[model samples]
Target: MKKLMMICMSLLMVIGLVACDDDTEGMKKVGIIQYAQHPALDQAHDGFIDALKDEGFEEGKNITFDDQNAQGEGSNAETIADKLVNDGNDLIYAIATPSAIAAAQKTTEIPIVISAVTNPEDSKLVKSNEKPGGNVTGVSDLTPVEDQIDLLVKLAPEVKSVAVMYTNAERNSELQYEIAKKALEAKGIKVEAATVSESNQVQQVAESLVGKVDAIYVPTDNMVSESIANVVSVTNEHNMPTIVGEIAMVEKGALATYGINYYDIGYLAGKQAAKILRGEAEPKDMPIEYSSEDKLEMGFNESTAKKLGITIPEELLKEAKIVK
Candidate 1:
């Protein structure tokens, strides 16, 4: 009878261990790989985390996150993605173009949701925004390039020649440059291309444009955005105003910017992630989203404007979020 009781107790303990294992398996794991540690990317990460929490998947509860940043290096992006895939994450959130491309290349089995990427189509990440046609979809930071150029023209009427500076190797920057070239040409504004392949080249690129153009326009190219202080220092030294692609550029002393809020775009991406998590939708089924009107913000740096001795017209100021 004692031997029979021992066998039953052992069986009960085995059953309890199996139940605990099943319970632990209920939690989903997510991996987030950001291309760089910039303000815009950081805001997106924060927004993504916040959105997940709002969706009832608290970080330590039913969800686990493996977040990593590539520190603005393309090679680092690939390494991070590979690590995430090897770790067997249920879903991957890739921020920025390089990270997205890296993650997509690493795995098609795991769903990838990208944020802050300007042109998903141009980057060949998706077939279309309506139907992504793959295991990848997310939010776009593709603020209307023409609208931003128009704002630049409006801000600097004397800007007959605009110097467009970007990293030549960046696909997103090339895409923006192509669109801006046509738009600026349509307005009879001569657009000069100042291309750089590295962050150190930005200062030389910006300095080279000093006498060649009336004003400079910096796109949201990762290289340029990451080293904007260098570009700003050069442009400011020339007393030339700059119209930037992201709001953080304005905060870094760009004269003005008509761009989408990175945080808000990330929040939108996060909402899409929630849908995927709940199994309400798949990444491939969900169309990529952009910031709505409310999420778009235009910021102007008054100090920078004053430093450049450029008076921002009252009309543009009315439309801008003045940054002190």
Candidate 2:
């Protein structure tokens, strides 16, 4: 009777092992490649995960996420992209332009949803915004460069000249620079420009602009965003008000900006990922999405304003969201 009981237990163990294997095979995997560790990108990552959760893709159950950060290095992003592609993720979420470009170069089979990328077509990640023509489509965090500049004028009416600071390596930054230069010229604001090839150069570059320009215009450049503290240290000392491309910079110590919510952009991209995972759509056919104009909000740093002795205009203060 004891021998018979042991045999029965062995058969049950084998059945359980088979069941577990089947469950593992059925689990879907998603890989996330974030370009940097800034708050804006961090918010986007969390929003994407929350979106997947809301869509019933519960972690440790039906889905798993292999999230990797490139540590603001392009090579790291390329390596991480290769790993995600090799691991056979059902879908990949890329948080920045570099990460998205890395993943797009890695695989055509895996659907890639990107957030915070300015111009997909310009980046060559997609054939066109209207038709992706490949397995890459998501949300763009393209802030209104003109509107942001106009907001700067309203906040600091004394700004007769402006310095545009950005990292030269970023294609999107270059794109914004061109538009901003034209807009600044159009508005009759003399534009002084500076570029940094590396983050370590940001502080020196910003310092060089001191006393040369009345204000600084920093676009949503990843390197500049990551090294914003360095930029603000110089600006704050000079009481220079820096108008930025996104709210995250304002929160970090820059003066103000009119931009889209990074979380909203990520959530929208997550929804796009869900549709592809559900077989309801393909990325190639999915039109690239953008945050609605209504979603853009003006953000101000009250502490920075007070430190710079720049009085916030009453009407503008009422319209802007003060950073806590």
Candidate 3:
């Protein structure tokens, strides 16, 4: 009789644990904080949602999303993070480094996932990329600076000097700039960099580079993306060729880029988020992932090429996506 009673109690405890396991199936809230509105960031945000749906967390059914864009302001990221936490979201998806940093600062309890960040370790968002050792983990879109410089030289063989511009406040931009300098110099290309104090300063800085360099290289810097029109105006006037980090900027006015697919990285982050949401994974143990090499695309702007009076090679056009 004593043995039978003990077995019955064990069975009841198992049932309770099973019930707890299904908690994620009912309803969930996901808060997304984006750094700004740009094609790369936009693709990431959309892909993240698609991935969540693929994982069976459909919005308005099992999950709801509270999406907010910082519109290129750093301080707004922190405020948005606080708001998401106060609203009781189950998880926070921070797109871009600024938002991710803000989210990490907001709460250690809430599982924070990031996308489009460069280096989690340098940013202090995670203890280490391999172990994380904290409540934050996500995908990084680290720029392939060396490959980009090679592309620039290949596309414009006469590009003796390249002007690089980025926002000074961004650590990732500074890192890429330093990388570009060494890479370009090795290939016998002179590298000059200008610092934009803020978005408004991009134009003056860009205009300052006219006639000084043969081509310009723009990194995946948020401020430059936000006020890209200013840089575009200056470059177009000078017929300067600009090689950027992604397609959207190339489409806008830059010459070309061989860069990561932002959507793919975002989708990767969402899959990780689903694991956390379902209680199958914890932030501390999940390793940081990067976008695969095959996911990258080579793109060139035909309209900008025409405007600059430069004829793209037939072989190059066949392989690259020509954006008009």
Clashing pairs in 1: none
lDDT over C-alpha atoms for residue 63 of model 3: 92
* Candidate 2 structure quality by residue, lDDT tens digits, 1-324: 999999999999999999999989878899999999998999889888889889988999889999899999999999999999999999999999999999999999999999999999999999999999999999998889999888888878878899899888889999999999999889889998789999999999999988898899999899999989999999989988999988889988998999888988998988898888889999999999999987888989988988888887788877779986
Cα error, residue 206 of model 2, in Å, equals: 0.7
Residue 183 lDDT (model 3): 93
Off-target runs (Cα >4 Å) in candidate 2 are: 1-22
Highest-lDDT candidate:
2
Q: Write the per-residue lDDT of candidate 3 for residues 1-324, one digit (tens) a residue.
A: 999999999999999888766765578999999999888999999889999999999887789899999987889998999999999888999999999999999899999999988888888999999999999999998978788888887777878998889888888888889999999899888888888877778888888998898889998888887667678778877878888888888878888898988999999999999999999999999989999988888899888888887888787777688887
| TM-score for each of the candidates | 0.93, 0.93, 0.90
Model 3: which residue pairs collide?
none
Q: lDDT per model, in order? A: 0.88, 0.91, 0.89
lDDT of 1 at 100: 98
Q: RMSD of candidate 2 to the true fold?
A: 2.2
Q: Give the per-residue Cα lDDT of candidate 2 at 38.
A: 95
Worst 10 contiguous positions by lDDT, candidate 3: 18-27
Candidate 3 or 1, higher lDDT: 3
